[model samples]
Target: MKVLPIFLLLFYMALDGLHAKELPSNGNDEVIFPITELQIYADERGFVNFSDVLNGEVEFVISEDFQPKDYSVDSYYWIRFPLHLNNIESKQWLIEFYDQTIDVIEAYIPTLDGSYKKITMGDHYPFYQKSFDHKNFEIQIDPKLHGEIVYYFRVKSHTYADIRIAVRSINRFIEYSLFEYFLYGLFYGMIFIIILYNLLMFIAIREVKYLYYTFYIFSVGLYATCVDGIAYQYLWPNSPQWNQIAHGVFLFSLIFWAMVFGHRFLNVKNSAPRLHKAIWAVIFARVLLFIYAIVFDNSLFEYRNIEILPLSLIFYTGVYVLVRGYRPARFFVMAYGLLFLGFLIKALLNISVIPFSIVSYYSLHICFLMEMLFLSYALSDRVRILKSNRDRAMQRIILQHKENVKLKDKVNRELERLVDKRTTEIQEKNIMLEEANQKLNQQTAEISKINSILDLDNWKLKNNIKEILQDRLINKNLTLEEFNKIFPDEVSCFRFLDRLKWENGYSCSKCANTKYNDGQQKYSRRCTRCGYDESVTSNTVFHKIKFPIEKAFYILYLTNNRQNKYTLDELSEMLSLRRNTVWNFKKKIEQAFSDKEDSHLIITDLFSYHINKKVS
Candidate 1:
């Protein structure tokens, strides 16, 4: 609809008085008109081409509204302003464009002979291409060479560009340029000074908050340079593409550091932890938007108003913390308050709510300076409050120490009197206690010697029984009860698998990592390198078998025999399992180890050798 484009145009109408000048329709012999201020009047000629204007097919609506046209990348704006060069004798005249960030400007200068001279100028071109080596585009006018002429300028930019143009004499332009550059020097110099001071403070105190503020201030200065075209003129004159997105990049940096610094300085993590988390979320969103602007659509960077969210959030946090009686946030609140006022003033100027002036136009820059100063004060003020509290704490500790010393002296006097009386009795009791301890030690030594002999016998019995049970498992067909002696339950079977699977060494199948710790599950090793959790039964013939592992071991022991000792129905009865399920697993065991006749491989060998085969 018409609403969207109209809104963009209105929002981006940066400044007034860009242009429209036309030739007085006088004959070629002599063309002149009376003028006092030497300013050209223009009309907004929308979407018309140079050919149409040259052929006299277009009618110009001469009005004061014909200022520097707000830029929309989709449409071209032509300013048709008439120039009346009357009584031109010696004073030199030139057209100067105030907005240096216009992407393109096609200026058509007319001559007395009904012909025009075309000159191309814009920030899109190299800085050296401009006739004047200044931030604003300027074209010298030869007034004596032509009588009457109309000037047409085609203005377009990627973002909002101030379209204000002023016709100044050569001397006047020089004076204005010098004064402007001087102010720029002061502005940027102050920013540089602030950055240096904060850097030193960061080093001296080792507080990261100062460092964050320094970066934020640096970003603000860089964004200001991008906005005023000083960066394009001086820093990267040869790189026109960088000039287009410089403002956007620095603006994002400014907001990013502002959020971080505000979060730290306000101690949001301690005071408002929920909002502290919200700050990180907003920061993540801003990063995503910035990346999308850079990679997918750079024009999205022109949506500078999106910054209002973070700025308002920071301002609200400052106010909220201040309301909660945070002393340091007072100055922080004031700083952002004035900064928002600057944004508001600039917005008002864009909407024509406020009259245009240098201060109003440069409101943001002025506010940035004030905000930096107040924030620095806030940092120092926070330190002051902390130091004051620490000193009070030290004073309290000293008073408490004196009281503790007096009590210690009184207690020491009473203790000395009590110790004298008990000393002789304590010595006599200690002598008696030593004699009893000696006798007790002699009895304890004899008892310990007897106990060690019994422990040795107990260990020998347990080892021999284990060896016998293991031998019985290999030699004879194990009944379910006998199998329980070797693989008593699922846990015993799992331990056998755990030891049998990694008898050589552990290695991860996924990453080939050879190191591991215990996993969350029992009998499972977690690989240290790849974090792969491998269970004991993984990749084994018994994997996913529904019955208990001890039953499976019993079935395997029966199957490992030259003939299966137990019939499928017998195993179903003994293990309380289905006949078909027992038969299926008996066949799997047979296929895994049926290579040799009367093979007597131990139950542990079955797990290691046939481990690669999985249950289908």
Candidate 2:
């Protein structure tokens, strides 16, 4: 696909050459001159007609009437020759002239005789003369010369041989010119695209290499254009002053781009830092040469020659890289090789050491075109390689991400299991705590019931004591000791008196004394010697007692043991006492206990009977 265009271009070059020719028009008459030999004759009279050259060294005579004119003067003369023929024929030929003084001059074959009949020279007429013999011809010269003149003429054979050669030459020139123009357009277009594309790449990637490559490509393109002569022909034809400078600039840029593009393309540092530095040194030398050219335009030729040395170095470096298996270096070597060969050929041809022709002019451009195509392909290959690697890397990244997700899921599952186990353990502990709380609540309820029973027993025991004290009148002279012996297994007699005293100590029952008897014996025979037959129990709890002390103590013991008021009532029934009497006894004892509670002193004295009994 790529080679097709090159083939077509070559085909056009060939065809253009084959078909090219210069045709004669109606106003131009072709001339043909025939001569056996050219000879020079001289005579004493200076009148010479030395037309025959085979007569042997004839010192031909010259007419004294002729005056020699200096043909060295800058002037022009119109000359014509007639061809006598039987039938009208058009002839085309190229006239060749050799002269050391051929200045700006124009010549054309005249198609008509007497075309300028009125035009005269100094003494003769300017007109073509017809020949007497039909096969013979006459040559006419206008503005006749007065001195010796030398001129040789021949007709460029328009025959097949000559035509073929001329057509080939002319066509080759045109084809080359057109091809060069095309190459200029192509390379310039490529340079523009490269610059724009790489500039955008630099912006997008922010890679310094892209910027360097952009500058390098631009420089290379400019240098290539200039070296190819396309810059002169198309870009700056009228600017002759820039010609030398353009050459220097082209060489400088070529070396610069060579170094930069090579360094970037080959990964110079990793591949060959020493070679890279050498290449840069060569480039720097080329830069110096360029500067010298700028500073001394007159010595431009010398500086240009100096530049070629660095260019040679660069070429060798490229060759080394390419041989070392640098992939891009292959293209670089190929392109630079073609360019260098083209330049060498052009230089040889331009110096006239070789004939300058169309093939020579365009061969360089074709090579350049080939170079550009190869370089572009190389760059495209680089892009493809980069894209492929990127895709692979992206795939790897995606796979890694998927693996990471799987690992994360496994971790989450493990964490969830741990959380569930912890929750279950906490729930079990809460249940155990609830059971323990329920047991504690039952224990608390039983303790409350036991306390209530103990309270009831205490109340019954206090009531029994009150009943025994209330029977004082009926049980006169009944000593507490005797009372205790009657209820032997019950409260002691001293305890009964202590209970009665606690109830009636503040109120004298016989005397109705409200003052407490602090010194009175608990079982005194008479209340403070009253001697009125009043017993210590007179007007006290014992005065009103109906139940026997022994039975009452038994009931108290039973009630205190059972700790139930109902048990006390049953016992009373067994003793054959009225329920009302037992009940009244219970009420009076409770009341007496209540009164004792109010009258008892919370004494701090250690010798108090209350304090001593509490300790016992």
Residue-level lDDT tens digits of model 2 in 265-384: 767777777977887777677667567767865345423334455556656777776678766677767776776776677556544455535587566666656665666566666677
Could you tell me every candidate's TM-score relative to the true structure? 0.60, 0.39
Lowest-lDDT window of 10 residues in candidate 1? 28-37
On TM-score, the candidate that comes out on top is 1
In the order shown, what is each candidate's alpha-carbon RMSD?
A: 13.5, 38.6
List of clashing residue pairs for candidate 1:
18-68, 20-42, 20-80, 20-81, 21-80, 21-81, 21-82, 22-81, 22-82
lDDT of 1 by residue, 98-159 (tens): 77878889888754444567889998999999999899898887766543345677777655
Shift in Å, residue 13, candidate 2: 37
Error of 2 at 185 (Å): 4.8
- Whole-model lDDT, candidate 1? 0.76
Q: Runs in model 2 with CA error above 4 Å? A: 1-238, 300-330, 340-361, 418-616
